[model samples]
Target: MTRMIDIIVPVYGGYEESLRCLQSVVSNPQQTPYRLLIINDASPDPRIHEDLRQFAARHDHVELLENKENLGFVATVNRGMAFSEDNDVVLLNSDTEVANDWLDRLVAAAGRDERIGTLTPFSNNATICSFPRFCQSSAMPDQWDVASLDALFSRVNVGEVVDLPTGVGFCQYIRRVCLRETGLFDVERFGRGYGEENDFCRRAARLGWRNVLCCDVFVFHEGGVSFSHEQAERIAQSQEVLQQLHPDYHALVEKHIQQDPARLQRTRVLLEMLRTSPRKKVLHLTHHLGGGTKKHIRELSVWLTGGMDALVIRPVEGGGAMLSFGATDSAPGLFFSLPQMYPQLLELLRAAGVSRLHFHHTLGLETCLWGLPHDLQLPFDVTLHDYYFINAHPSQTDTKGRYTPDLDAQSSSYPLTVSLEEWQDNQRQLLQKAQRVIAPSAWAVREFQRYYPGLNYLVAWHPDSEKQMPWPAVENPYRGERPLRVLVLGALSPEKGADILESVAVAAHKESAPLEFHLLGYAYRPLADAVIEHGAYSEADLPRHLQELQPDLVWFTAQWPETYSYTLSEMLLAGLPIVAPDIGAFPERVRHRPLTWIEPWDSSPEQWLRWFREIRDFLAQQNRHARPWQDQPVPRGAEGFYRDSYLSEMESAGEKELPAVDDAWLGSLLLQSRQAEGRQGRLSRKERLLMHLLMLRQGRVGRLVSRLVPVNVQRKLKRKLSRKPIHELHRK
Candidate 1:
């Protein structure tokens, strides 16, 4: 059926915005026949009157109406809606710009179902209907113009509509039949606008009508144009009335936000934008457990800023993967179930403009990722951040948590469904397909090559600093009578030598040695009270903490061979005197420095304490501010690798032969895997409790708890909440 929409644009003030709105409407005519009925509601600004008159006179289909007295927004829109009897009416704000048959798209969306009482288009400032961010005003994406973006939206989200509690009045399409049933806006309650549309939507909903967001249309809203001065006052009054009339309104909206049914649609448009852009994008695949690998990807993304875009894929805990976009750590990510959506995942990546793949680590990811490059036919690169590629043990450690040269000796000790040989073979196959393989250090290159034997490797150190200042040796921090302060850095898991840390602290206390220990990062479990645990610290916060601690020496008790230590890089940059395990890249990176000691990898607590005492005596003999500064050439780190190899133009994996797997068979495998993993169905009771606590942290109860409890107590509680049970850790 043919539809005619009366586009009722109520003009109050803001002549520039009003003119742009009318001009855009004129430039982009709707495919569906529509009459532009512009109503001037006694605009305070006289300039809008003559402009509207001339605008109407120039166009044959334009109809202009004016009120003698100012009737306000709620009354003005109602007057216009009543102006057209049979046809549908669109209450368009005069501060908005429409493009590319926007009205036609709205009408088409309304035609999808008779029960759809009203529809709103996506806008830059339309609250819940806003793009990029919901319930917040955002500027139109800089790369796109209105017409182009509108066209893209129309192409990508055709026939898509997300249900909303209310249709935003900025660009609302109200059906005439629904309007007749629901009646007009309550002008008495909402005099100058605000919650009037929400009230109407609620009334319509009560009458079994739906309010929806038309995903295919794009409109630019220059908000606060009309009723700018009276906004705060009117909004408060409208909200009060809404609460009294529709008590469930706020709850419904909040529920919608929590559910976020429109996230996929928004992500689709965002990905489509990236897909069409000329800039090359690289997708980095890593594990969910953050460490140096996650840091490397984040730094890589920042380094690729303006040169290329970076996307990261990390496995979810149970059985999915999360894809985080752009350079910022806080940038939004999407999570999807794996195996089941394996084929669709490839298609989505293709749509997201992922031209190249960079595997940082894939330990916890699903089996599908092992064959990703071959399945998707995308050329890739690899970075060896750990020994996960060659052994089940990430640190290449024995059962006793010490470096082991014989990789196969403790194979059975590491729990896994597959044999260590099978695991290594899978990783080997995955690595053999890479276009290039990179390691952060020469030591890492040597270790990885011992397993693979023939694959060529590139050495690129992880980027540490943008400003390479000289390594300035600090003054001796030890004063005559005080116990020497020893500091440790990074997360202290078992392989990281948390046990060694605990033993050393205990030994010092027992022997009454003049030694004090402080930890900058957390341990897998709580340590001795004597070892001051400062908990987790960010790279940015490290310098400030170091200055305050004024440690005599920094110690690393790592029990295994590390591929590359970012913490070591930080300590080196700080120029502090150090003691580290003899194994791993520590000797390779820091052996040549003076005032540095590399201890045996399996050093006893008493031996570590003796070294600390010797260091204290050595510092006591030196001058208060003694050592000189010297400059050294900085290595080409991860940033350099990104700049050299990844910044270059790349080809997309176009039209690859996707794997054809039987759905029923694949589903059976996935179900069996879930059942075996004991992760089938919804969240467990404990998980639900955790989720409830998280919710409370954002609600009134959270606020009350914050006020009633001491900050220190709160911090302790937070630490407890984030830590896994000791039994769970032991099980692993």
Candidate 2:
């Protein structure tokens, strides 16, 4: 008779996610008898032991093992497996989510052939929510079976068994014979992380045991688990050991990681219903995984409109993207577009099919960039966009609430550029956390060097201007002979200069410049009285409108330091020379072309008309020189503005040393250390978090939040002056 299935969870920190993991595991609807084995690896934070004690007291099937010393990965996995009395021992990563029948499936698969020593499961996507929620991210894909099927959905066979390559990562179902013969996990040889699985699998295979993949068993795994920097270093050191153990496996591991031919993003909608946001979720997860955070500067990426995807990269990976948003106390009228449609964007990025992500931005990022723990786990470099140093007492103003576009002053206390003590307090964590930093501009490079001294950073420039030009140059589709119809595109808000455009339209009508102007965009008012009120036209409507109105010039006027104008880029691509405010990155992106800049002094309609007329006449004279900005010789380096200039130099790059720990209400530590750590050693990430709470260090801000808000609240609430998160966007 098959005695029992012994399960092991060796963790350091990760308390909450761990709790959820256990709840899922113990409640795993399997008829086969099972027992849970939890090893505490002398975790610095102790609450892990306390939670285990509480859990063990309640569950008869659970057993607890404590390591008095902080036994690294090698000893931990082996120690956990040793505590198992069952014939079949399942080595499971604490961060993994297992399906209900995951156990039976793996056991059956591994038990199929006497030579089958171990069984593995094909993986599923995992997510990390954006900052702040880095403390508590509940986002994940659904593992439940489909109650109904859709024609567009990928046919999932659910429980059908399948084979695996060499190793069974995360979920490894090992046989008793293999363990007895080869010993559990090449303890000394494999050490921890990466190649250990392959090493073990190879060994099992060599021992005449077959390693099968139980494709039917779906498992969810986070990138890394909660741990301190020291533990992480120790984990990295294991890589050398892995290469030494089996030199041949080195190529295989490198091939698997680097040769990820298809762009598999962290976020992708698993089912037809939702998408994940990788950036946001990955940020949140950095805390859970043995990783950290970094400061980031915002860039007015012209041409690539942020829309909503920038807000969340997880939905595109794990679940489907979000669509509509409800009005919130913070940002009213802030429409959340395309979150649910992120799969399309992810598909494009993947289609780029580059092995690693290579992108750039001009400015430095904010102090509180990616909200995650400081133990940065990823071993790769991503362009940081920027880094800065703080000097004197600084005041910042950006992102200060502009949900209504024209309502507030055109700047925010956007901290992405500061290197002040306060900024460092927010950024040091990410700085200490990111694997490598890439600064696109020399200014950004200086800032990064000033703050994160000796850190591995590259002062790289964005690929030359030509690469940035949009594709498929089209002739003026709106061929006009009569009224030289003009199009004013963008949100019909105050800063968008909609009112100004209204005056321009009236002025044009009065002058009878043989021109008719139609405002095209999403209607924002109670009702759109004109052709378009929101003033923002969809891509599909653009061609139709062009064919119908045959507009001559597309004017994009934003009375703000708006960078990289997407509208301008589109106009340039459409062979339509545009009239846009020459500020921020706009001048840099669409340069050496006939355009009009809105000067502050020229507020009168006549003055605007004169300039508009000159612009139109220039367009008429240019003989369809409407090719992309590629052929246009825009003077380089002329486009320069500190994205964080609003922030005093004192605050641009961190000034003072790293900030003192947040004194705000570290009233208690969650686990109180005693129960937090186990006999074997440290607790998991969840345990450490609980321990911090128990120690009164953080997590209970009673008066801070009074209500539960949905994810959709951000966009709708940004316009509410009273709502701080969104209220920063106050109307002028």
Best by TM-score: 1
- Which residue runs does candidate 2 get wrong by more than 4 Å? 84-86, 125-155, 158-165, 190-194, 228-236, 253-597, 600-732
- The sequence of per-residue lDDT tens digits that candidate 2 reaches over residues 86-141 is 46788777776665566766666665577777776545431111111111233232
Runs in model 1 with CA error above 4 Å? 1-151, 154-161, 167-211, 214-247, 254-264, 317-340, 351-353, 409-413, 416-420, 464-482, 538-552, 570-577, 590-597, 620-639, 652-681, 684-732
Give the Cα RMSD of candidate 1.
Answer: 9.3
Best by lDDT: 1
> What does each candidate score in C-alpha RMSD?
9.3, 23.4
lDDT of each: 0.77, 0.45
lDDT of 1 by residue, 1-732 (tens): 686789999888888999999888888866788889998989888798898999999999899999999898889898888987898999889999998888888888999999999999998888888886667787776457888888989987898998999888888999999999999999998877899999999999999999999999989998988779888888788888889999999899998976666666666677676766666678888876677888888777666555556778877656777667653445556555777667656766655657788899877788887677876667888999988787666787665556777656434234455776887788888788787888877778888877887775787766554323455664566675799999998888677898899899988999899989999898755577879989888889989999888887899889888877888878877878888888777886664476778889797888888878888888887777656544433444544555676556477333232233343443343344334334433454555565566557667668566456543354345434533332333233
lDDT of 1: 0.77
Model 2 C-alpha lDDT versus the unseen true structure? 0.45
